[model samples]
Structures are given as C-alpha cells and as structure tokens.
Target chain A: AQSVSQHNHHVILSEAASLELGCNYSYGGTVNLFWYVQYPGQHLQLLLKYFSGDPLVKGIKGFEAEFIKSKFSFNLRKPSVQWSDTAEYFCALSGGGNKLTFGTGTQLKVEL
Target chain B: EAGVAQSPRYKIIEKRQSVAFWCNPISGHATLYWYQQILGQGPKLLIQFQNNGVVDDSQLPKDRFSAERLKGVDSTLKIQPAKLEDSAVYLCASSLVAGGHNEQFFGPGTRLTVL
Candidate 1:
C-alpha cells in the first residue's frame, strides 16, 4: 500500500535559523503532494501543495516545499524560522482520488 | 466563506459505548471527508463522500463505524461499541471538488477518548 514517511520526529531550532523537514512517499506513480501545519490548539492548515507545473512551491508564512519526483520526496523548507512557526508538520500524498495518505508528522519547536 | 465545522470539541466514552461526531462542510463544497488523527501521527482518511453519495470508505471499519452525508451538506460519523483503539481526534474536511488536486479545509476536530 501507499504510505508517507517523515524522517524527523522532533526538531528544535532557534529563531532565524534555517529549517528543512524531510518527507518521502512509497508510491511510484503520479502523485499530488502537500504540506500541512497545525499550530497548538489550531486546526490543520495547508502550507503548500504540488500538483503540476514547477516542482518548487511556495506557501503561506514563508514556507516552501520541493517536489523531487525521482526521489519520491517533497521536502519542506524555510529560509528563516520564527517563534510562531513552532507547530506540527505533516506531509501527505494523494494518488488520484480524494483519499490522502499522510506521514507520521514532525513536531518543530522554535526556541527563542 | 466559512471553513468546515465540527461539533463537540471533545468526547469521552467508556469502552463498548457509542459515540457520534457531526460535521458541516463549507458551502458549495462537493466533497466531504472524515479522518482519524491519533496522537503523534498524521490524519488517516476514514471515509470520503461526494455530495450525498459515498465515494470511498475502504479504510473504515464497517463493523463498528458508520457514516452518512445526508442532503449533501452535513455529515455524521458514528462508532458503536467503541474500543480503546478508537481514541483519537476525528477531523472533518471539505474540498471544492472530489479530485486529488483540490485543497481541503479542515475543522477544529472532535477529540474522542475511549476509556
């Protein structure tokens, strides 16, 4: 079955530091990738998505993800992190239908 | 437009009890979805509905779980004789269309604790 994997279980960084979260999927066929973020006590919100066109997609809050089809990976990145960016990040993949397979998730703690 | 709405922000039920969650999708959305989010894990799709019709429910445990989207607007997911493993946050999401590319909007979710 198709599955998503997030390598980092928890990551801690100081404000203004660079950030990268690794995500990989098992499927080899065409896929739609997404990055979702959940702040403490808030609902899950879309960070970025890759459907077609360019492989690098930028999302709200200065977040971006690179979809590497050869590696079956979509890694999320931010040039500089903020205290407000402390949240749980999830990587998800949908092959064709409305159903999505999500990764285990990564908890990012941005220190002061 | 309003985002997805889910009722009963939290629920606590003993094992073998029953529980139900309600969700109201955003207006004009044709796709509704239910997901189970366990602690420290990503959300898992439990079922999907295209309007009032079921699109996919292969992951749903049909013996104990049931969901319906009557009138193609509001939806309900029920768990009968809930088990300890059923303790998780139930999230409701909706999208403009039923395809894979459309972005999905999620609600606050209903946290269910099966004791």
Candidate 2:
C-alpha cells in the first residue's frame, strides 16, 4: 500500500525562523504530492501540490515544496515563517485516483 | 461558493451506541469523500463517491460503518455499535473531478467521541 511519512512530529521555532518539514512517499510509480495545513479552529486547506512539470511548486502564504523524485521526497519549506504559521502540517500523496494517503502529520508552533 | 458542510460538529456517545454524520458537498462537485482523522494523526480516507455511485470504500469498516449518497449531492455516514477506538474527526471533502489532479475542498469536520 502507498503511504506517506513525515519525520517531524513536533517543531517549535521563533518568528522569522526558517522552516523545513521533511516528507517522503513509498510509491515508485507516477505520483501526485500535496501539502495541506490546518490552523487552530480552521479547516484543512491546500498549501501546495505537485502534479507534473516543475519540481519546485509555490503555494499560498509564501510556502513552497520541492518534489525530488529520486529521493521519493517532497519537502515543504519557507525561508522565514510567521507566528501565524503555527499549525499542523500534513503531507499527502495520490498514485492515480482520488484517494489520498496522508502522513502522521507534523505540529509546528511558531513563537512570537 | 460555499465550502463542504458537515453537521453535528461534535458528537459524544457511548460504546455500542449508533451515531450518524451528515455532509453536503459543494455545488456542482462530482466527487465526495469521507475521511477519519484521529488525534495526532493525519486524515485517512474511508470512502469516496462519484455522483450517486460508489467509487471506493476499501478502507471503510463495512461491518460497523456504512455511508450513503442517494442524491449525489449530500451524504451520511453511520456507525453502528461504535467502539472506543472509533473516536476521531470525520471530514468531508469534495472536488470538481474524480482524478487526483483536481483540488479538493474540505469541511470543518465532525469530531466524534466514543466513550
């Protein structure tokens, strides 16, 4: 079965600090990767997605992810994060259909 | 446009009790999905529906869980004889298409607590 893995279970950082959350998928075939974020009391929203073409995909709120096929990794990164970035991050992958396999999730707390 | 809507945001019930959750997908969305999210974990897909037909229910525990989308617009997930391990947030999502390339819009989710 296809699965996603997020190494960071919890992360705490001061505001304006750089952020990088590791994600890896187990599938070897054609895959579509996605990063979703959920703020406290808010619904889960798409952070970014990689379907094809570009390896580096930019998403809302200055978030970007690089899809490295060789490593089976699509890591989410931000040069500088804000206090508002404190939320739970989830990495998901889809082999073909609408079904999405999600990782255990990473909880990030950005302090002011 | 309104996002996916789920009713009974929080539900608390005893083990062996039955509970149901309702979800209304976005207008014109051809695909609807239900997922389970336990605390400290990411959401897991339970079932997927395309219009009034079922697309996938591989992960669903059919013996204790069942879902229906008769009108192809709204859906309901019912858990009979729930167990303590069934406690989780039920999320409903919708997309314009059934493929993975399309973006999926999610609801606020229904949190279920089985005592």
Candidate 3:
C-alpha cells in the first residue's frame, strides 16, 4: 500500500534557527504534494503545494519545499524560524484521486 | 471567503451508541472532504464529495459509517454503534475545484471521544 513517512516525530530549536522537516512518499508516477501547518488552537492551513512545476516550490509564511522525484521526497525548509512558527506540520500527497494521503505530522517547538 | 464550518466542536458517547457530525463548506466550493485524525497521527481521508455526489469513499468503513451532502453545500457524517477506535478528531475541508492542484481549506474539527 502507498504510505507517507515523516522522519522526525518532534523537533526543538531556538529562534532564528534554520529548519528542515523530512517527508517521503511511496509512490511512482505523477503526484501532487502539499505542506500544511496547524498552529496552536487553529485549524490546519495549507503552507504550500507542488504540482507539475519547477521542482522547488515556495509557500506562505516564508516556507518552501523541494520535490525530489528521484528520492520520492519533498522536504520542507525555512531559513529562519520564529517562536510563532512553532506548530504541527503535515505533508500530504494527492495522486490520481480526489482524496489525499497525509504523512505523520512533525511537531516543531521553537524556543525564544 | 469564509472557510469550512463544522458543528458540535466536541462529542462523547458510550460504545455501541450512534453519533453524527455536520459540516458546511465554503461558498462556491465544488469539492468537500472528511478526514479522521487520531492522536499523534496524520489526518486520514475518509470520504470526498463533489457536489451532492460522492467522488471517493474507498477508505470509509461503509459497514458502519455513512455520510451525505445535501444540496451540495452541507454534509453530515454518521457512525452507528461507535467503537472505541472511533475516538479522534473528525475534520471537514473544502476546495474550489476537484482537480489535483486545488488546496483544501479546513474547519475546526469535531473531537469525538468514544468511551
């Protein structure tokens, strides 16, 4: 069965630190990738998405993800993190269907 | 534009009891989705609707779970004889289009606790 894997379960970092959350999916062929963030007490919102474009895609809130098709990976990156960036992040893939499959979330804790 | 809306922010019920959750998608949205998020896990898609018709429900446990989208705007998800494993956050989302690139907008989920 197709699945998504998130390498980090939880991460802690000080403010202004660079961040990278790993995401990989088990699928061959075409796929649509997405990154979503859920802040404390807020609903999940789309941070970015990738679909038949340049491998590198930029998203809201200074977030970006690189879709490496060879590795089946789409890793999220942020050059500088703020305390407000602390939240749960999820990676998802939509392929050939209406429903999307999500990876286990990564919880990032940014300390000031 | 208003995001998706869900009712009964929380629900608790005894095992074997039946319960239902409601959702209202954004105006002009052509697609709606329901997802189940267990503690410490990613949200899993349970159903997808295009207008009043279901587009995909392959992951839904049809044995006991049922959902409906009336008037192609609002929806309801029901579970008969709820089980303990059903305890989780039920999320509702909607998108303007059904194509692969459309991003979904989510609502505040209904946290269900099946005791």
Candidate 4:
C-alpha cells in the first residue's frame, strides 16, 4: 500500500533556527505533494504544494518544499523560524486519485 | 471566499450512542471530502463527494457510518451505535474540483469522544 512517512515526531528549536521536516512517499506514479500546518486551536492550512513543473515550490508563510522524484521525497524547509511558527506539520500525497494519504504529523515547538 | 463550515465543534458520547456531523462546503466547490483524524495521527479520508454524488467511499465504514451531500452544498455524516474506536476529529474539506492541484480548504473539525 502507498504510504507517507514523516521522520520527526517532535522537534524543538530556538527562534531564527533553520528547519527541515523530512517526508517520503512510497509511490512510483505521478504524485501531488502538499504540506499543511495546523497552529494551536486552528484548522489545518495549506503551506505548499508540488505538482508538475519545477522541483522547488514556494508557498504562503515563507514555507517551501522540494519534490525529488528519484527518492520519492518532498521535504519542507525554512531558512529561519519564529516563535509563532510553532505548529503541527503534516505531509500528504495524492496520486492518481483525489484521496490524500497523510503521514503522522510532526509537532514543532519554537522557543523564544 | 468563505471557507468550509462545520457545526458542533465538540461532542462527547458513550459507546453505542449515535452522533452526526454537519458540513457546509465553500460556495461553487464541486468536490467535498470528510476525513477522520485520530489523536496523534494524520487525517485519513473517509469519503468523497462530487456534486451530491458519491465519487469514492472505499475507506468509509459503511457498516456503521453513513454520509450524504444534499444539493451538493451541505453534507452530513452519521455514525450509529458509535464505538470507542470511533472517537476522532471529523474534518470537512472542499475543493473547487477533484484535480490534483486544487487546494483543499478545510473547516475546523468536530471532535468526537466516545466513552
């Protein structure tokens, strides 16, 4: 079965620290990748998405993700983080269907 | 550009009880989805609807769960004789279409706790 894997369960970082959340999918076909963020008590919001074109895609809130087809990886990255960036991030994949398979989310805590 | 809307932010029920969730998708959206998000896990798709028609429901527990999208605008999901394992957040999301690149706008989910 196709699945998504998010390597980190919990991550703690100081403000202005660089962040990278690893995501890998187990599908070989054409896939659509997405990163969603959920702040405390807030609904999940789309951060970035990758479809066809360039491997690197930028999204709202200064978030970006790179889709590498060879490794089946779409890793999220941010050069600097803020305290308000504390949230739970989810990696999802959609291939050949409208359904999305999501990974166990990564909880990030940013310290001041 | 209003986002999706869901009612009853939270609910607590005992096992064997029945509960229903309501969702109103964004205007002009043709595709709506319901997902189950267990604590500490990512959201899992339960059903998908397109213009009041069922598109995909392979993951839905049809034995105990039922859903409907009347007029293709508002939808309801019901679980009869809910089990303890049914406790999870039910999320409603809508997209303009079922395409791969269409962004899905989500609503604040209804959290259900089955004791």
Candidate 5:
C-alpha cells in the first residue's frame, strides 16, 4: 500500500535555529505533495503544496519544501525558527483520484 | 468567506455507545471529506463526497461507521457501538471541487474520546 513517512517524530530546537522536517512518500507515478501545519489550538492548514512546475515550493509563514522525485521526498525547511513556530507538521501526497495519503506528523518544539 | 464548520468541538462517550458529528462545508464547496486523526498520527481519510454523492469511502469501516451528505451541502458522520480504538479527532474538510490540485479547507475538528 502507498504510504507517507515522516522520520522525525519529535524535534526540539532553540529560537533562530534552522529547521528541517523530513517527508517521503511511496508513490511511483505522478504525485502532488503538500505540507500542513497545526498550531497549538488551531486547525490543520496548508503550509505549501507542489504540483507540477518548480520542485522548490514556498509556502506561508516562511516555510518551503523541496520535492525530489528521485528520492520520493518533499522535505520542509525554514531558515530561522521562532517560538511561535512550534507545531505539528504533516506531509501529504496525492498520487491520483483526489485521495491524499498523509504521513505520521512530526512535532517540533522551539524553545526560547 | 467562512471555512468549514463542525459542531461539538469535543465529545466523550463510552465504548459500545453511539455518536454522531455534523459538518457544514463552506457555501458552494462541492467536495467534502471526513478524516480520523489518532494521537501522534496524521489524519486518515474515512470518506469523501461530491455534491451529495459518495465519491470514495474505501477506508471507512462499514460495519461501525456511516456518513452522509444530504442536499449536496451539509454532512454527518456516525459511529455505532464505538470501540475504544475509535478515540480520535474527527476532522471535516471541504474544497471547491474533487480535484488533486484544489486546496482543502479544514474545520476545527471534533475531538472524540471513547472511554
């Protein structure tokens, strides 16, 4: 069965530290990738998405992801993290049929 | 425009009991979806509907779960004789259409605790 994977279960970093969350999917054909985030008490929202064009996609709140087709990965990255960036991040993929397969989320804690 | 809306932000029920969740999608959205998110895990799609018609329900546990979208607008998800493993947040999301590129707008999920 097709699946999405997030290897980093929990990550802790100091404020201003760089952030990288790994995401990989197991689909072979064409894919649409997305990164979603959930703050403390907020609903899950899309941070970024990649469909066809550029492999590097920039999203809201200074977030970006690189979709590497050869590696089947769409890893999310941020240059400088803030305490407010603490949240759970999820990676999702749509191979086709409008169905999304999501990865087990990674919880990031940014300490001041 | 308002986002997807769901009722009963939190619910607590005993195992073997029945519960239901209601979702009102953004006006004019043609696609609605239900997902179950367990602790420490990503949301899993349970069902999808397109304008009052079932588009996909492959992951929904048919024996215990049932969902409906009536009049191509509001939707409801129900679980009968819920099990302890059913404890999770039920999320409702909507999009303009059932397409791979459309962005899905999610609601504040209903946290269901089956004690």
Candidate 6:
C-alpha cells in the first residue's frame, strides 16, 4: 500500500512572502507526482506535475516545486505570494493507472 | 474540453439510508475514478474503472459502497445502509488515458452528510 504525507497542516503567510509546502510519499518504484490547488468553494486544479523530466517544475500562477527523490519530497514553492494564493494545497502520486493517492492537505492563508 | 461533472452538490441522509452520486467525465476519457474526501483529510480512491471495466477496487468497501460506469461515459457511486463514516465529499475524476502521463480532471463533488 502507498501513502502520501504533508507535514504542514496549516500555513500562514503575508503578501510578498515566500511559501513552501512539504510533501512526501512512501513509494519505491517509478512514480508520478502532482500538486493541486483548491480555491475556496472551487474544485481542485492542477498546480504542477512531475512525470519524467527535470526535478524542478513550474506551474500556473507562479508556482513551482522541486522533486528530491532522495528525500521522497516534492515541495511546492513560491517566491512572493499574494492574497489570491490563499488556498488548500494537495500533493498526489499516481502509479499503474489513473488511480492517485493524495496527502492530508495543507491549508494556506495569505494575508494582504 | 469540458471538465468532469458531478450531481447533487449536497446530500443529507440518515444512518442506514441509501444514497447515490453521479458523475460525468470528460468526453473520450478512457479512465474514471471515484474518491472519498473526509472533512480534513485528502481524497481517498475508492474505485477505478478503465473503459467500463473494473481495474482496481481494493480500497472500496464492498459491504456498502458500490460504483458502476456503464457504457464507459458517466458513472455512479452508491452506498446502501450508509454509515457515518460515509459522510464526505464524493469526488469523481477522469483522465485521458490509463497511463501515468495523463492528469485527472475533477468535478465539483457531491457533499454527503450522513447522520
């Protein structure tokens, strides 16, 4: 059985502040990693994904994440944040087929 | 392209009652999935279907939870004699293919509240 973990349950940041959300999964074989964002009252949207490319990937809305295989981490990061960035972030992993395993999620609150 | 669609934005049911959630995936998608999302936790995969065939359902509690995707277009998730544990958002997702390259498109989800 595979599982995903997100250490940060809640994160608070101010405008223009840096942001990072920790994500780690317990899987040994080949895996596809993804980060999804959910705005208040909205569905989950893909922020970024890492299938088989550079460890560093950039996504919509000025979001990026680095995949550190050694640590089993795919941390989401943003240099400067805005109030619009306030949303719940989820880390997911997929293998075999379309089935994905997601983390507990981290709720982000960005102050203006 | 249209994203996944789920009906019954909210559902309230008493214990031991039965409920069903509907989902319409993106057109031509080859794979579909249903997930249960508790209030705080992440979405948990309950069932997987590949072109109208069951691919993986190891996590689905067959004792009460059941799902089907007939003709491989839209799908439905049902829970008979529902329990409190089943009170959560039922999220339906779909992908262009079954492989790892494809990303899933999600629906608004149906919020089920079991008393």
Estimate every model's Cα lDDT from 0 to 1.
0.95, 0.96, 0.94, 0.94, 0.95, 0.93
What TM-score should be assigned to candidate 6?
Answer: 0.98
* True-structure Cα RMSD, model 1: 0.7
**What lDDT tens digits, residue by residue, belong to model 2 across residues B1-115?**
8999999999999999999999999999999999999998899999999998999999999999999999999999999989999999999999998997888999999999999
Q: How well is each residue in B8-89 modelled by candidate 4, as lDDT tens digits? A: 9999999999999999999999999999999999999999999899999999999999999988889999999899999999
True-structure RMSD, every candidate = 0.7, 0.6, 0.9, 0.8, 0.7, 0.8
| Docking model 4 quality class | high
Q: Candidate 3: lDDT of B102?
A: 88
List DockQ, one per candidate, in order: 0.90, 0.90, 0.82, 0.83, 0.84, 0.84
The TM-scores, one per candidate, come to 0.98, 0.99, 0.97, 0.98, 0.98, 0.98
Query: Highest TM-score: which candidate?
Result: 2
Enumerate the chain B TM-scores of all models.
Answer: 0.98, 0.99, 0.98, 0.98, 0.99, 0.97
The true-versus-predicted C-alpha distance at residue A95 of model 5, in Å, is 0.7
Q: What tens digits encode model 1's per-residue C-alpha lDDT throughout B68-110?
A: 9989999999999899999999999999998889999999999
Candidate 2 ranges with C-alpha deviation above 4 Å = none
Instruction: Write down the DockQ of candidate 3.
Output: 0.82
Those runs of model 4 whose alpha carbons end farther than 4 Å from true positions after fitting are none
Q: What fraction of the correct interface contacts does each predicted structure contain?
A: 0.88, 0.88, 0.77, 0.75, 0.75, 0.81
Tens digit of lDDT per residue, candidate 5, span B19-69? 999999999999999999999889999999999999999999999999999
Candidate 1 Cα errors over 4 Å, as ranges: none
Worst lDDT window (10 residues) for model 3 chain A?
A92-101
Model 1 fnat? 0.88
Question: What is the full ranking by lDDT, best candidate first?
Answer: 2, 1, 5, 4, 3, 6
lDDT tens string, model 3, A1-112? Answer: 5678999999999999999999999876689999999999999999999998799999999999999998999999999999999999999998866568899999999999
Better of 2 and 4 by lDDT: 2
